[model samples]
Target: MKIGLYFGTFNPIHVGHLTIANHLAEHSDLDQVWFIVTPQSPFKKKSTLLDDHQRLEMVYRATKDYVKLRPSDIEFGLKQPNYTIDTLTYLFEKFPEHEFALIMGEDNLKSFHKWKNYELILENHSIYVYPRLSKGNVETQFSNHPKIFNISAPIMELSSTFIRKEIKAGRNVRPMLSDNVWHYIDEMNFYR
Candidate 1:
């Protein structure tokens, strides 16, 4: 099986995230796209993030109906400041029979070289990059790379940070989030 891993904190799972996953699963060579919910990203600020379990539950609620899109808690058990290289190595060891690929936005690709063991990641795994709004075209170095494939997924300007701000301001964020996720957030009074 060729699984594409889409990693994020998912502070609250939103439609943009789901859309990317759906597009990758449908349009790419991947058999499935797993939403690897990171408890805390090394590059992101931890102050604004929700509790790990809460974020995980939101992911579960949002992805419950999609067979091709599954929510993963693989990073939950791992230590803080999870690194992509370490996660990929662990996944490779545990699921030797399955082929793993990385799913990310073109914006992330711009900073790809800064990631830990990025060269190894490019050599060992395939990467499916979706277009992101506001990000410029792919750089020449990675434009024609064999392991990096550019996908035409819709560019949603929506973001988790924006949604959080809306919720905190008591605004309706229904359009930004999945039905169940919105309901869960409303019921829990999250981000308030």
Candidate 2:
């Protein structure tokens, strides 16, 4: 089975995220897209992030209605920083019957070189890259390797940071996030 592994902190799963996953499911060769919730990443600043379990719960609530998108906590058992290479390796060993592809954004493309065993990641897993609004006009900016891909995905101006800021400011985030996720956030008093 072809699985698209979408790795993220998913502080609060948003509509933009669901749109990309849905697009990948509909357009790509993959049979399923797993939203792999990272506990933490060395590259990210953790102060602004929600609790890992809460984030994962939000992802689950957001995606529970979608059959094609699966929420995973694989990184919960893995090492800190949650590198893609290690997760892929563990998945391969655990489920030899399945194959996974990485789903990433163009901005992250620049950080590709910083990942652990990046070449090995390229050699083993396929990456489905969606264009980022900030990647500029330069195409294939991180094309040192042939495995890097470019695909057309809806680039929404929205972001988790923006949504969080809105929530902090007592602004309605209903239009930005899924109803289920938004309700959960309110019920739990998240981002306060």
Candidate 3:
């Protein structure tokens, strides 16, 4: 199977995330897109992040209806300060029969070289990059590489940070989240 791993903290899965995943599943060569929920990212501050299980549950609630998209807790069992290279290596070893790729925004490609073993990732797997509205033009040295594909997926200016801020301010975020997720957030009083 050809699986595209869409890795993110997913503090709360929003419609923007769903739209990108759905677009990738429908437009790309990938058979499935797995939203690999990261418990913690080495590059991000943890103070603003929700609990790992809460984020994971929100991802599950948002993506449960899509057959082509799956919510993955693969990083939950792995060590904290998870690195993409280590996760990819582990996945390759565990699922030798399946082919894996990475799905990311063009903004990530701008700093791709900063990632650990980035060259190895490019050599072993493909990357499907979608545009992000806030990101400027990507000027990567690896632009010509065959494994890197630039896809024209819809760009949403929305972000999880904005959603969280809205919730904390007692503003409605219904349009930004799935119905299930919105209800859950309200019932659980999340981000408030």
Best by lDDT: 3
Give the TM-score of each candidate: 0.96, 0.94, 0.97
Task: Give per-candidate clash totals.
Answer: 0, 0, 0
TM-score-sorted candidate list, best first: 3, 1, 2
After superposing candidate 2, which stretches have Cα over 4 Å from the reference? 135-137, 140-146
The number of residue pairs in model 2 that clash at the backbone is: 0
Angstrom error of the Cα, residue 10, model 1: value is: 0.5
| Winner of 2 and 3 under lDDT | 3
Residue range 55-106, candidate 1, lDDT tens digits: 9899999988999999888988887888999899889988999899999888
Score candidate 3 by TM-score against the native.
Answer: 0.97
Instruction: Quote the positional error of residue 144 for candidate 3 in Å.
Output: 1.3
Ranking by lDDT: 3, 1, 2
